[model samples]
Structure formats: C-alpha cells, structure tokens
Target: MTILLTVLGIALFAFGLLFSIAWHELGHLSTAKLFGIRVPQYMVGFGPTIWSRVRGETEYGIKAIPAGGYIRMIGMFPPGEDGRLEARSTSPWRGMIEDARSAAFEELRPGDEDRLFYTRKPWKRVIVMFAGPFMNLVLAVAIFLGVAMTYGFATQTTEVAGVQKCVIAQSENRDNCAAGDPVSPARAAGLKAGDRITAFDGRPVKDWATLSDRIRDTIGPATLTVVRDGKEQVLHATLAKNMVARKDADGEVVPGKFVPAGYLGFAAKTEIVPLSLGASVDRMGDMIQNGVESVIAIPQKVPDLWNAAFGDGERKADSPVGVVGAARISGEVMNLDQPTTNLVAMFLMLLAGFNLSLFLFNMLPLLPLDGGHIAGALWESLRRNIAKVFRRPDPGPFDVAKLMPVAYVVAGLFIGFTLLVLVADIVNPVRIT
Candidate 1:
C-alpha cells in the first residue's frame, strides 16, 4: 500500500509541475496573441521536439526537457546590419527602422506599417512581458485563498502552551541538555506555561518577533514580565548560551558556525479561524509578500544553511530534492491518520508557497529567465531612444542569445544544486509529526 501511495503521489506531483509550466508559458502566449504579436510557436519544455503539430499560424509542441516552456515570436530582436533589406526596393536602414517600429505596435506586421516590438511604447512592452510573472502571482493568490477558505487558517496566540525539558538529538540518542535540562528561562523567571509574555527587559513584547528580538539582543540575564492568572509579575533568569540549528522557510539548513544563543523551549497555543472573504484576500497578499521576501533573501542565507547542515552534525548535501522530494513529502502527509480536508489544505498551501518561490526566482533579472528577456527588452528600448535623441546610429536591442554562456553556467550550478538537495532529502528528510 505504501508503495502504491508513493507511486500515485509521484504521478500527481509530476502532473502538477507540468500543469504549472504549461500555464506559465500560456500566460506569455495569450498576452502576445491579445496584443496582435505574431507567435510562430508555443511549446512547453525545451530541447528537441518530442511531438509537434501546426495549428493555423502557430506550431504547438512539447520538448524532451521538462524544465520550462516558451513562445517564439518573430522580430523579437532588431535585425542585424547585413544590408539584406537593401536587396529589396526599400532602403536597408528604412527597413530596419520600420521593423523596430513594427516590433512595438502589435497591430503592424513586418511588412505592414511600423508596428514591430521595437516601435511599441516601453510601458506597453513592459506590461506585455510582465504579464507572465504576474499571472503566476495571481495563481498563487488564488490557491492560497481557496485553501485558507476551505480549511481555515492557523493563528498563533501569545500564550505559552507546553515546555519540553530536554532537547533530544535524534541521530546520537543523547540529550542536548543532560543536566536535567535546566528550567526554561521563562519558567525560571517565574513565567508558567499559561503565562503571556507582555514585556521583556522593560520593552513591550507584543508578539513572537518582539519576544524573540528581546531575547536575541540581550547579552546576559534579563527580566521578563508576564501576565499570569490575569496579574503581571516580573521573573528573573540568567540567559545561557546554547547552540541551535536553524532552517529556512524552504527547509534548507543555514550554513554557519554555531553561536551560543539564548534558549527558549516553549510552544505557543495556536487556533484556527475561518476568515472572511476580505480577510482571506488580505492574508493571501501578506503571504505572497512574505514568500517574495524569503526568495530575495535566499542567497544571503546560503552560508547559514550550510553551517547548520555541516556544523550541527547534519549532512549538508543530503537535503537537496527535485520533484521526487515533493512527491515523498506529499505522500507522507497523505498517509497521516488525519482528516483528509486538513491534509488537502496543507498540500495546497505547500504548492502555493512553492509556486510563489518559483515565480519570484524566474522573475529575477538574470540570464535564461523570463525576467532576463524583459530586462533585455527594456534596455534595448532605452538604448534606441537615447541614440535617436542624440542623433546617433541606433545601438540596437539587447541580444538575449548573447547570454548563452551565462545561461550555461547557471544551468550547471542548478543541476549540481538539485542533485545535492535530492541526496540530502533522501538521507535526512525533514519530518514533522
């Protein structure tokens, strides 16, 4: 049964991934068509075509590589100065200028009035290119809203729930705090499980962030004021340094040396609240923003992840995973003896969050990405306008093909990283129970 469930989960995950890639490419194709741009081909995946069929003016197909998809548009870049246009009745320079103009005005084809991509206004072109990423963002928001409305949302309260005495090392079967796991700082300072931390070191502690900031910023002993049984009381405890491993939102370990840190082994009381339509939308926006911020911060946090994976006696490279990792996780979640609705909701949330990360990563203004093309388009537009105003020859559009080398380097790095993650996931998958 487990084997069958795992196989089914893998199949479902692959289906979802393909659907996402196709939808993302469809966004670009649809927008281009709406703007009257000539799309010669719309294909999902890359490499040699596995299957293809021509429909009207567009060739639809699938490629062997399942990495991504694209829509091939004519005159995507300015024509080279080969003087080929001069062979025709029109002057070469005049033809080049007309092609540039036609590139911008979606209404005009190559031979028609100057309506090329280059001729279109920058803002319009920006919108057309930006629509693809925007669509992904929209899909994420929809997924989040649907899941949250169906299963409600988890809300953590300030009240403390439980405190575990000793932190166990799973690999070595040793207690991290062998000396009877000294009383938690909060408990030692007179705060009980139900106590609400109202303030720390004389600063107001409104939420988890405030409480964590107070603890981390403090060098030594501190006073914590808590509301217990409806009365505020001051508790005193000396903060001791302890080593703790940290993981990012994506479950990747932060590479770094272990720093002696204040320890607090406490869980918060969390409740689920059914959100109103407006609240769901607001929460979805907040989640999307948080996801974007996390994606932007990944590069900076890589070192920390590495440290946690290696320094904490955890295998660093064992955490890498591809679609197989997603399948395993989803399968595990499904096998849990819980309400199917909850499981489905969790899966949806995970998918939405993952999609948000993928969307943001692809939109980075780097080579071999959708954002790179958009960046090239914008740069070319700027360069051409500047040259025209200065009465100089057109500098021409930014050639995305020129970034092939950089794209190759990025692809190599990604391949290596994916393998590493896959190994890590197989050997030491993160589990929550």
Candidate 2:
C-alpha cells in the first residue's frame, strides 16, 4: 500500500509538472500570437516527437523527454548585417551561429516578413519573452496564497502547551533542570498547561507574538491575565533574563543564534490558523526573497552535492533537488501519517515551490533562457533610444543570434550541472522524513 501510494504521488507530481510546462509555454504562445508573430511549433518537452498535429501555421506536439518545453517563433532573430540571411558555413562556431539562424527562419512563410518576432517593437518582444516566467510566478503566488489564506498554516497561539519546572538558559541546551536551578516563573506563578493568556501587563494579548514580545522586553515584574475553566485569572511573576534562541519575524527560531531576553519558561501551543490577505502577501514576499537567495546559493552547493553523492558525508537538508528528488519527496509526503487534507496541502505546496523555482531559474539573464531574450530586447531598446536622441540612424534590432556561441557554452554547463544533480538525487536523495 505504501509503495502504491508513493507511485501515485509521483504520478501526480508528473502531471503537475506537465501542466506547469504547458502553462508556461501557453503564455509565450498567446503573447506571440497577440503580437502577430508567426509561431511554427509549440512543443511541450524536448527530444524526439512523441505525438504532433499541424494546426494552421503552428504544429502543436508533445515530445519524448518531459524535462522542458518551448515554442518556436518564426524569424526569432533579425537578418544579418547585410540585410540577408547568412548561408550555411563549414566552420564549427560559424556553423553553430548559422544553424540557430536557420532554425529561427525554418518555417518562414511568405507573409511572415511582417510577422517575424524581431520585427515587433522592443517592448512587445520583452513582454512576449517575459510572459513565460511570469506565468510560473503567477501560479506560485496563487497556490501559496490559496493555501495560506483559505486553509491557514500551523502557527503558535498564546495558550500554554507546557510549563517548565525550572528556568534553564537555552544556551545550556539541556531541558532537564539541575538541582540548584531557579524555579520557573510560570510554575511559581501557578501557570499551568492549557492556560490561555488574554493579556500581558497592561496590554491585551491577541496572539503569541504579542505576548512573546512583551515577555522578552521585560526583565522584571509582569502581569499575565489567563482564562482557564471558563474563568479569567490574573497572575504576577518576575521574569528572568536568560540566553534564548532568537526567533525570526515568522516566529521560527533562528538556528545557531541566541540572545539575552526575559524568559517566561513556557511553550506556546500551536494550532492550524488562517491568515489575513495582508499577512498572506507578506508571506508570499518572504517566499520570493528566499527563493531568490536559494537560487543564488546553487553554485555554492555543488561541492556539498558532490560529496553527498560520492562520499560518505551526510546530505544537507538544504541540498539542491532536481525533478527526481522532488518527485521522491512528493512520494514521501503522500506516505506520511497525517490527515488527507494535510497531505493534499503538502502536495500543493510542493508544486507551488517547484513553480516558484521555475520562475526564478528562468529569470537568470543568461542565454537559452527567457530572461536572456528579454535582456537582449531591453538592450536594443536602450541603444535605439540613445540613437534616436542623438539623431543617428536606427541601429535596428540587436542581433541576438550573434550570442549563439556563448549560449551553447551556457547550455552545456547547465546540462552538466543537471546531470550532476541527477546523480546526487539518485544516490543521496533528500527526504521529508
């Protein structure tokens, strides 16, 4: 049963991935058609064609490899400097450039002269290229906000889960109280498990964050108004200064960081709680920022990935995951001993994270990616505006085809890195368990 469930989860993720790829390509296709660019091929996945059908000017199809997808726009590059498409060359580098140029013009129909992609204005071209990544971004934000605002997240509440027997500095790292340790303030003040804190000192406490902040800000006397057995009670205690783990804005402890703060010596209860639209937006922003940082940190993680795959080293929890690794995680998530709703939410979150990664990854301004084309268009716009201001001749569209050689190198490096990650994922896969 577990194995079957794992396979089902993997299959579900595969479907989600295909849908994401199709959605991404649909953005480019729609925008390109809207701008009157002639698209000859709209393909999901790469490698040999599995199935296809020609519809009007476009050939829509699915390919054998399910990794990535693309839509081939006619005359993606402008003609050469001489105002004519260059002939095939025998030199290797020249051949690379010519092949790309030829592919861009492969299905060029007679009327396509005006329908060529490069014939569009620079800003329009930017929109056409940017649309793909933007689709993924939209999907990510929608999923994240849906799960957060509708279903809520597991969050800390002001109710006490447990009270400490004695005060122990977090730096000490041991929960067991020593014989000479001071009695915990909460215990001494008659605070018990299941006590719901209604207020702190003179301030009304609506949530755990408010109460925690108030407790941390004071080192001496504080008043806690609690509700227990449907009755309210006020308790007084002297908070002690102690080394404690620092928490982030999300109320999660920052690993390896400690600070001196007033200690209350009790654990806050956690509950599944929904968030407001503003809070949801704030969380989405944080996710985007973290996603950017994770993408930036990929190069640095290569060594660790290599060690984990080939050596006896333990795999780091933050290790980069490929599709295979992510699918495996999805499988594990499905098999977790949790409620069905929680499992479904986890799966949706996984898909959302994958979409976010796709958005961030393709936005790197390097060749063969959507951002690379967008960058070229922006540069062309910049240069043309400068020429217009100086009353100079129009420079025309930037010859992005000239960057074919560099694009080839970038593509090769990406392929190599992907293979490395594949090997690592198979050998030392990251697990939710």
Point to the candidate with the largest TM-score.
2
Model 2 clash pairs? none
Q: Write the per-residue lDDT of candidate 1 for residues 1-433, one digit (tens) a residue.
A: 8777666656666666667777787887787777666777889888999999999878999998776788876655443356222233275544444444344333334563343443455555666677777777777788888877767877665678875454332333354567655555655555568888787777887666557545655656888777888898887866655565444544334665344457655667776656778879878877877767776666664554454444453533323235556767777766677787777787777677657767887788876677776787788788888999999997655655445556667768767766555554565555534
Worst 10 contiguous positions by lDDT, candidate 1: 80-89
Q: Clashes in candidate 1: how many?
A: 32
Q: How accurate is candidate 2 locally (lDDT)?
A: 0.92
Off by over 4 Å in 1: 47-52, 83-121, 157-269, 276-286, 300-321, 385-396, 426-433
Q: Model 2: which ten-residue window has the lowest total lDDT? A: 80-89
Cα lDDT computed for each candidate against the true fold: 0.65, 0.92
Q: Compared with the true structure, what per-residue lDDT tens digits does model 2 show for residues 359-398?
A: 9999999898998999999999999999999999998889
The TM-score of predicted model 1 comes to 0.63
